[model samples]
Target: MLSLAGWSVLIQASLAAIPSYVMQCAYLPGKILDGVDRVNRNFLWGSSDSAKKVNWVGWDKVTKSKEERGLRLHSAKGRNIALLAKLNWRFQIESEALWVKVLKMKYSIKRGRDIFNKGSRWLVGKDSGLNVWHSNWTNGGSLRKLIHGPITQEASFLEVKDIMLDTGWDWGKIPFEISLEIKRMIQAIPVTILSRGAGKLIWAGSPQGTFDLRSAYRLAMGNNMVFNKKNRNSSLALEIVRQALEYYHCVASPRLQTCKVLKGIRWERLPQGWMKLNTDGSANGNPGLAGCGGVIRNDAGQWVVGFSKCIDITSSFVAELWGLREGLILCCNLYITSLEIELDAKVIVDILNKPAYVNNIISPILDDCRLLASRIPQIRVKHCFRQANRCADSLARMSVSLDSVFSSFHSSPVDLLDVFEDDFNGVNVNKLCPEPDVPL
Candidate 1:
């Protein structure tokens, strides 16, 4: 007896409760999916399955954003894969854990040594754990295979740091005759003698030096591209089935309530006589190809100007700072007096606001941003929700494929027009807020 809107909310609530990791591992049977799809159709039409097909748009369109001409419902399969990819990502990046060790030992025992051996290499930190000869430190194979150095049995287990010097590698101390190839390989190894602790393993073919589900899913989908073409409407069908199953699951948790914090906020215009700037940044991978984008608007919420810049391989954090710096520079050139800058990244705002010195790789970029901000008159930088910064987000994403290092737009891009209109209209965007914790 529930209305379509009521059913939709109920279904979403059910979905929110189920842990995404469970769905990632357990592939639901086809029969279960059929029953779920049947229920979704029922709730969507508010009628039985005997009735004519009520679905107008396909499911593929449903999962896309409003800008993409879709309803913005996430695909169950896509979500599952995305979640599961996180597990694989953690396994590669994180330090050894009980669970990780267990999984590794389990697979290695069943598959044998060749299973884990893929010519992968590790960056030496303190070089305490690495074995000089047995470990795969050299480019092609173990160093022992290349040069069987004459040494006492006790020295056979020598670590990589044993030959390290304060300045650089001490290649002369080794007893074996160093070949040209071995010497080249030794020089190529990025061993930091000052660094403390065990070295970290690097996953080959990962551009960001870390694992990502988006990358994993892209690879998985590529293999199934032929299958996808066969059923171009597969997304459409999957959406229907997903909704039905969600509704059935909702019946088990009627008491659950959806949070309303996100729906309550809307994009607001700047104060009179002040310009508003919204900035965003994106990277293909954490330290991969990145881009910075920003949009400046007048008091009336009309776009004054926008910018997109393709930055070389850099972290997303640096990209965000660059976006703000670029926006400030443009505003200064335009002779804007009072300004308000908004960004979706809270971490960047925190780092800038603090007085402490940043001694890391990003210290120079952070200092540049701070210096630029000081020159701007009556400027205030604040954090806003990503939902409200759609135009800037879109521009940043577009910068990824741009050939030019920098580009500026006097007017809004065609693809961002809808999002711009939505912001101007003060449309309420749905964002799921975390539920309040209740003591049992």
Candidate 2:
């Protein structure tokens, strides 16, 4: 009987044989073993001088010999070991092939240069026929064509890593060098896609997709970069498109389309003997406890008239309409010809400018203001900002606290001339509105 140590050694040898045997069998058609044999023969006995040396037939014979020997050497005690070894060998071979393909593709730009330029004599010059009398013909046209456009350098790994970080990717655990390389690979693909305008088609097809890319680009470039401005505007345009898409899809909020409508006339002054009127409204809560305000400032910075009132209304829209009405009534009462009016509400402005009327709630009031404004000679209505007219906002806020006092004065035109006159003449207030018409 064999000793235990000797038996163990035999078992180990047998186990190692199975995988090598399987690989030899599987790769027979590919002639993998034939290549190995040639290498082995060259190493051991030197290459044969024969032109038609050992080829695929010789490799097939070697593989067959190895497989037969492996099968005969297999034993029940080593079955699991043999199976595992074969599996490992197969996996390793697959992994190596995949890695080789990846490396080749990754460096294709540099490696493919020769293949791309194979037929171009302009790129690869020919040897002269005679050394002394060399006739060198130039292919300048082909060379110029090949070199068209600027040659852009690839982004550095560090630059790519910085871009990835700006996009909110966390790659801190990866080694700096590895992370940078990976980032460069990822960004390079998108940059190429974007430059070709192919990326726009992809983004346009999906809702909000364009906006997301624009935002991503902005984030990558950073706020300080000039591209950020361009990207941010692009993002806004995309957002508008996305909003429209949502509406078309029936996913938009109803309130998004609803805008405040005003009922007041705007007033202003023209250089050629005319007064301009403007009306505006403000509401802290929609359809509830709203405020209406209007201002009538002439071209001379003199306040002809202005009023702000808090009404127990349901929406800001109503308050806005009320402001228009108040301004129109004031203008009509003042009998100011050549009236110009302004408001900050775009919807209200549109309504007044166009003959068509919408929004039943404010239509009647808007009509009333329109009729009154029409009665005046050369009446005009325009939009102005909340900041442009502080007097109006202050009055609106004050109306909330003094609702009872203003409502009581509806029957009579409360004189605000003295109050404004005193305030305008005040030392502290005068500096700011030094020449009230001269905007700061």
Candidate 3:
């Protein structure tokens, strides 16, 4: 019933109109659009379900504008793309639109990010990464308030890059104008000039320097900079304490692990041809008035030799080393061939058993003790509890009143007679942790 021009008009006004309208709202699958195109082709060519005719122009060319010398037809795919692009442009331009506000709320930084900014700090990987006074590096706060007086013109724009050296921190770049406390705190932080590029910012609120909302909230609620600083300080202190405890457990626990009750412990007499030497050291305070005492005994549990030396103010470690060294020297002088050494200090016992660590103050004494021990034909060093070492402890405590640097007693002193007799009798006392009336 329809001619070619009439078929074309019918296809445009009816068949293409429906899909073009749908394309403006949403994309139509390519296969569905292709089926519509097939129908349009069949209609234009006067083909029907009964028979088919050749399609003269490809659908692509048919869909081109009239200037391209083909029937102008709406492309379902093209219409979908143009609609989407227009919508996107509109949303961007209309700043006060509902969708724009919704997106801003979803993605934009709010007050939470401000608190996050306060918690962020620069980790130094490269020299130029941080501005000295402007950056948050020292104690999770800046050096702005800590610095005293007017900042010099040349130093106004000072950066971490200018003050670091290959060897370490450049002390020369440090301003003498700042307080000594500020200088000390700055020097305490290590800087390496080994890395390249501006270092990244890290969240100082977390232990790993990662950003988290929990720490940010706490930091935000903090009263002021000092409050925030205290929080950071407490975190740092906890970490340091954990590390110290680990080191102590590794070095001391093995030697010091003791029975809570003294009923499980007692001093014993040495075997024939063996000499037992008990040594102890005491400090009024760890680094205050210190002293060392040692007593050597025979198989009969009779005192062979006893000595006490008043060491000047020093650490308990140095004082313990002093006692052991003196005992070894006494044995070497007397040519006591077979000997067993006992000390109540686990730390000293640990030091003796392991290879000596290099210490500026304690190494010399430690080295002497090792050398003297090696000279003997036989030696055994062990850790003993305070209950087993009472005589030597009492003697060490007595050194606090001694005027002489060193003193020796051939006979058991009257003050330590009870402790000496108790040892000879293998007496035991009730020494326990949470020890009442007993030193920890």
Best by lDDT: 3
Order of models, best lDDT first: 3, 1, 2
Estimate the lDDT of model 2. Answer: 0.41
- Please give the TM-score that candidate 1 achieves against the real structure: 0.42
Cα displacement (Å) at residue 240, model 3: 18
Could you estimate the TM-score for every candidate? 0.42, 0.33, 0.41
Greater-TM-score candidate between 1 and 3: 1
With candidate 3 superimposed using the best TM-score fit, by how many Å does residue 311's alpha carbon deviate from the native?
0.6
lDDT, candidate 2, 133-187, per-residue tens? 1111111112223322432232222222233332123344323333333332222
Point out the higher-scoring one by TM-score: 2 or 3. Answer: 3
Residue lDDT tens for model 3, 299-337: 889998999987756557667888887888889889988
CA deviation > 4 Å runs, candidate 2: 1-269, 403-440
Clashing pairs in 3: none
What's the lDDT of the predicted structure labeled candidate 1? Answer: 0.65
- Top candidate by TM-score: 1
Arranged by TM-score with the best first, the candidates are: 1, 3, 2
